[model samples]
Target: MKLDRTDRDIVAALQGGLPLVAAPYAQVAAELGMDEAALIDRLKAMKARGIIRRIAAAPNHYRLGMVANGMTVWDVDDAQVAELGALVGALPFVTHCYERPRALPDWPYNLFAMVHGSNRDEVEEKRARIADLLGGACRAHDILYSTRILKKTGLRLRRKG
Candidate 1:
């Protein structure tokens, strides 16, 4: 999408993140010399145009004391994966979930959900809940734990010269 000067300014201001405050958008609007509603309208329009997918919090699980993180992969029946994945993703302990194509031959897991807790035991308990949710639809499953943290960030725009 071709972002105008104001839209470019908005993306630049938010690339780092919205300010940590009660009214983050309002603060950003003030910084950009625009009102809150106008900034929000621009954001909504961008989203509709496929310029932005979403605005959401990307919290640090480690800082939040959710040190144990496991991505549980399930070899689920293809017919029921989408419905089951949605249930698994909605679990309170589940950080994220999605369906992926099975690699076949060497790999077969097609559904994945990231479960988090303070320890492995808690993560296992959450996994059990997901297993129950999947029931007979799950053929096999495995969990892969994170070994190290990676920095996560949103889009970064280079300044026009």
Candidate 2:
């Protein structure tokens, strides 16, 4: 949808994410010289129009002592991938699980799962549990542990105009 001036302002404010305060919307409203009710209305409209996908907290797993994280890839039967992906995503240690198109010639993973824990052993244990759950449906899998984090932030909605 074509955004108006107010919509553009709201998008720009949200690009940085909601402030951590008792009344974050109000704080944003104050900063943008708009009222909280107006901000809420615009956000609602933006969501309805599919301009805003979701509002969520991007937690810092490392700071929370979840130091070990692994992106586990699996090659599963195409028919069972969706069901198993859902099951994997339900696991607490499995932070992310989704289906991806098979990687190219150099890469061969299909299904992707993210497991995180306080340490490497814990992450490995989680991987084992996921493997047991998948049974023979999973043909092959591997874990790629994270070595460094570059950047993490919320989406930027507004484009220079």
Candidate 3:
């Protein structure tokens, strides 16, 4: 998409993160010297055109006492992996789930899903739910928990190659 000057400015401002206010769009529009409605319209158009994939909030789960983060991996039938991955991804406990290419005999997991909870037991419950959903299609699965918390950052825009 061809982002004009205003669009670029809008993207630039939003890259830093949206305002934590009641009327965030209006606040940003005022700062950018554009009408609130115009800003909303441009954002809607950008989303419709696939320029903006999604707008979501990323919170520090650790701070909220939900420190246990698990990177659950599973080996499933190749034919059913995509369908099963979609089902696992849709699970409420499964924060982020996707399919990854597996290596030779060493790495057998092709599907990966991330789950978070206050403790290991909670995370295990979520994993069990996923296992039941996968049924016989899932050959093997494991949960790799995060030992240390990592800092989170906002999205960064880079120049096209």
Candidate 4:
């Protein structure tokens, strides 16, 4: 779908993300000189057309003091992987959980979860809870910690008029 000036303008304006305030969308619309309703309509249309995905915030976990985190990889039984994955995802300690394609004989972990805590012991306790929940469905699991802080950046676009 070809985007007209208004569409392009909206995308460009929000590319940096909405302002942080009680009324973020309203504030953004005001800054972009767009009517709030028009901005909402344009965003809805863009989402419907698959031009934009959901908008979310990436919190600074380190600043929040959530320093202890591990990527917990689980080798779940194929027959019950999805069910067990949902349970793992619902855990309070799990910030993110999803199923990944197993690499087969060498690397057999199929479920990945981001577990966070204030320290290693807390992380391990959560891991134990996960294991208890998985029960027989969980074959084996491992936790991998980040050696350094991760840097995240938004996608960029280069365009010419």
Candidate 3, clashing residue pairs?
none
Candidate 2 residue lDDT tens string, 1-161 = 68888888888888878999999999999999988998998899889899888788777889999999899998888999999889989987776788989866756777899888899999889889999999999888899999877667866665667
The numbered model that scores best in lDDT is: 1
Cα lDDT, all candidates: 0.92, 0.87, 0.88, 0.84
TM-score: the better of candidates 2 and 3: 3
Query: Candidate 4, residue 128: CA error in Å?
Result: 1.2
How many pairs of residues collide in each model?
0, 0, 0, 0
- Backbone clashes in model 2: 0
Q: Whole-model lDDT for model 3 versus the true structure? A: 0.88
- Per-residue alpha-carbon lDDT of model 3 for 14-77, expressed as tens digits? 9878999999999999999999999999989888987887777777889889989999999999
Using TM-score as the measure, the top candidate is 1
Output the TM-score of candidate 4.
Answer: 0.86
Name the better of 1 and 3 by TM-score. 1
Could you tell me the lDDT of residue 64 within candidate 1? 92
Tens-place lDDT digits, model 4, residues 6-43 = 77777777777778789888887898787888789989
- Judged by TM-score relative to the true structure, which candidate is superior, 1 or 4? 1
RMSD vs true structure, all candidates: 1.2, 2.4, 3.1, 2.2
